[model samples]
Target: MKQRAITGLFFIIVMIGSNLLGSYVFSVFYLLLSLFCLLEFYKLVKQGGMQPERFTGALAGVTLFFFFAANCYFPAYKYIILLPILLSFIPIGELYKKSEAPFTNIGFTYLGLLMAVVPFMFFHAMAFTRGDGVFNFHVPLGFLIMLWSNDTGAYLVGSKFGRNKLFERHSPKKSWEGFIGGILICAFAAYILSNFYTEYNRFDWIIMSLIISNFGTMGDLVESMFKRSLNVKDSGGILPGHGGLLDRFDGLLMAAPIVYAYLYLISN
Candidate 1:
């Protein structure tokens, strides 16, 4: 318990510091982290007895990362979307040659890319577009704070008063009490932050908070499903108490795109 707490604090500090730095640096860091995560995911796929082309998959993953980075840094790069379609054939070819269940490999690989890379691109895009500093630091940091508030609230409340399960099969430890607590805390954070923003109204920020918190929880569950399927405890041992990069950003993975879309749709 003591180790976990210390690890958690250290993780938070590093994350907060990185987010404060802004978009280009954040995107660069994201690209590198995503590469590591992609490596871990590919390792999992290989372990599942699927013969996915590792080099091809890694290349495709890196391509996907840059494509997303382009989506943020250069919106005019419409050709970026086509990259996925083109690379989709690599997995498809592997699926075609399989004597057994080829589709599973192809599907898992594709889904992994979507689950891991696409939303992160959206996050990068959001970070770049929303702020006006060296790296558009404020938007990403605000988003992180919102996510952290939700996570902290859920942990504190769920540990104390949780009884009803949110989804026992996927995440046995989470409860409805914790879920609501997290949402309320996130909503409060949103309200508080809204006062500083002239662009979004109180209701808008609150809605964004709810979307982030709820989907973030679901995202964590989704990652849990992957880990459970692989029969592993944590995704990786990158963070001391936090498990892997994937484990730390599972919520952000889903929440980032949602927040980006919210800003894109409503604010724009």
Candidate 2:
């Protein structure tokens, strides 16, 4: 218990440091993290008897990361067009494969790539937006805080007050009590942080909090589904007492994209 607590504190410190460094450096870090996660995801899929082209999938993942990053740095060209073009190849590549589970492998790999990279890219883009230089740190930092709040709240509340299962089949340990606790804590954090954002209205912060809370839970469930399907406990053993990069950022993966879309819709 002591070891886990200390490890968790260290993880939080590193994440805070990364966010303080702003978007460009953080994007580079995220790209590398996504690459590692893609490898782990592919390895798990392969272990499950699926024959995905690991190298091809990895290359595609890297290419997709750059496409999104390009869009971030060069938003004027609307380089976002590259995303669909790269994504379209998933099915096309499956057609050339002689493997029995080509479609499933292709679909899973593509979905995993989107799940891993798109949100990180969106967060980066949000950070680099014009006239929002200082606010850049807040965008990613907000996400990290909300996600960590959900995770910590859920575990602490669920352990003490849990009764009704949230998802009995997929995640037996998750409970309604924990879910509500996480959402409430996240919403409160969002409320407190709203004072820091002079540009956004109260409604925006409230809505953002709601989105993060719900989608963050969905992200956790998504990863849980993957692990359940593969009959594995954790994604990887890279982070001490924290599982892996994927495990740490699962909630952020889902939350970031939703937050980006929210900002994009409101700003445009």
Evaluate residue 5 in candidate 2 and report its C-alpha lDDT on the 0 to 100 scale.
86
- What tens-digit string does per-residue lDDT give for candidate 2 at 1-268? 7877888889888878877876666777777877888888887777778876666667778877777665565543466566577667767777888888777887777766776666666766666554333336776677677777777788899999999999888889999999999888877887877888656777787788788878888888988998889888888888778787778778867778878888888877
The whole-model C-alpha lDDT of candidate 1 against the native structure comes to 0.77
* Model 1 alpha-carbon miss at residue 195, Å: 2.9
RMSD (CA, angstroms), candidate 2 = 2.7
- Each prediction's TM-score against the native? 0.87, 0.87
- True lDDT of residue 157, candidate 1: 94
Sliding window of 10 residues with minimal summed lDDT for model 1: 129-138
Error of 1 at 199 (Å): 4.2
What's model 2's lDDT at 134?
A: 39
lDDT (0-100) at residue 245 of candidate 2?
72
Estimate the Cα RMSD of every predicted model relative to the unseen true structure.
Answer: 2.7, 2.7
Q: What is the number of residue pairs that collide in model 2?
A: 0
- Candidate 1 stretches with Cα past 4 Å from truth are 75-78, 81-89, 92-99, 130-135, 197-199
lDDT of 1 by residue, 142-258 (tens): 778888899999999999999999999989999999999999999999988888864668887788899889899989999999888888788888777778878888897688888
| Top candidate when judged by lDDT against the true structure | 1
